[model samples]
Target: MPAADALPIPVGAIVALFLAAFPIFWCAILWLIAGMGWRRLANAYPANSDPPDSADRIRFATLALGASVRSANYSGSINAWLAPSGLWLRPILPFRPFHAMVFIPWAHVRSVASERRMLMKLVRVALGGDVPDLVLSGRLAQAVLDRTKAKKR
Candidate 1:
């Protein structure tokens, strides 16, 4: 094939290109929506929330976020609250807040349990929502559940 040999691509090729690209395009949109939606929820919460009372401070990472809470690339460990009422999963960047923050109520939690995850214990909390579950560290999850007096299953 010479430098200027190829003419305009065939219509079939164009259609195929679009078909292949659409999935990625749609995925990006959905991801943006999920992140923004959670960000809005986070901002809606009182930023001046009373300082964690008997709160178990933990290094929390938003492993995922969205209506589905799919797996993701979470970075920057931040201080989070596993309150007597809910779980605040988000980074505490002084100025740059994560788009997918979380605050989950205990009443909406269907179960609280733990299992081995690699070298650490992973506490799985089943919730009642579009994203019905979260995996946090055992130490933090246990402390929060104990304080909230939420039943475990």
Candidate 2:
């Protein structure tokens, strides 16, 4: 046999290719699986607005932060705010640019779910259970508004 034909492919090279490609394949599979599951779950829920035409309709979800409400401007357009306690959304066009915030409004929201256990697990791994505050200030705002309305009557 020729010396060139006698040399075998190295195991290390095969492993190196697998190691490099595995993550990308793993992530792609995970995303596809999660997306399908999510799509099914989403189909199970009635659209928060059944008619789908009403801008007034709002879907409820927990917000991880509340500071977005004060600093974010909602003066002109309909806005949705989420925090750990609850959600706040109003219909209007915001005339001013908001600061000190990255806001994700409800109108722009496509889906939500309580993955707190998963988050807690990640937090435990990364920072040893030092969980950040997940207060729902948006719901509190609604509650206060309700109470004020009740008091006025």
Candidate 3:
């Protein structure tokens, strides 16, 4: 008969390993965010406060920001709010490290165009100035466009 020996991991070692990995993980996330142009978006449309209570919220939305080549895809991780003033977007907690909530005013949204991609429909929103375009599903895009139109009236 043979018995197997069990090895216990030291609590301090586990803690130390986590401490060392945390910063690196955070840095990598920051790099990814920056690469996806979230930093640029933040610079242009930083949301200092939360979305208004009256704003209509869409959870688990899909959105793409920046150029298609280097876009940041927040598939099912986006919380989008449609207000009379603008469109508010923020990522879920885990993906929110360097991504500040952004509010792109209707005035800043230059254009909204709908296109069919294969079987799915998509909307491309062009913003003013140096801000990159925002691509979202057709439904969300329609909501945003509706808000903008309402604001104009």
Candidate 4:
């Protein structure tokens, strides 16, 4: 079907459709491209180890802003933190302004030694709240902790 003839078009619906479709579309594109490259790299050599024993106590370093240290291992996965409505998570690179993007595998942080605000920031962000660039949603932070705790059993 032609793009225009498929359905009735309203200006607001068009905008909503774009908003709904753009991220999923781009993420798929990026994942396909990145996954292809990652597969090639993995094929060239053996993996260092298995994915994980069971997503156990994997401590991830967090900066003051609550963002975990960036890693090249990022694959396309959605992670979020949860917190009360007041906080938010903002993505950022070291020494740079915040970003709205969330990268995965790299962001699959597993543990922390102490409780901190940056961690809270991450929780806020994960909950899809308006928070600083480098943060996680509080809900996600707890989920990570819970996952680790479960692994101990």
Local error of candidate 3 at residue 141 (angstroms): 2.5
List, residue by residue over 1-153, the lDDT tens digit for candidate 1.
556866588789999999999877766754564464445445444244543678666764433232243443243354567666666666555313344455666676677666775696556666544453555554565665565554443
Q: Which model, 1 or 3, shows the larger TM-score?
A: 3
Position 39, candidate 4: lDDT: 32
TM-score of 4: 0.24
Give the best candidate by lDDT: 3
> Against the true structure, whose TM-score is highest?
3
Stretches of candidate 2 above 4 Å error? Answer: 2-7, 39-153
Error (Å) of candidate 2 at residue 27 is 0.6
Tell me how far the alpha carbon of residue 79 in candidate 1 is from the true structure, in angstroms, after superposition. 2.2
Q: Candidate 3, residues 1-153: lDDT per residue as tens digits?
A: 433563376688899999999989887976776667778888999997888999999988988885476788778888889877788888887777778889888778888877777887788888867777888884676787666666668
In angstroms, the error of model 4 at 119 is 48
List per-prediction Cα lDDT, in the order shown.
Answer: 0.55, 0.33, 0.80, 0.36
Total backbone clashes of model 4?
Answer: 30
Provide the lDDT at 105 for model 3. 81
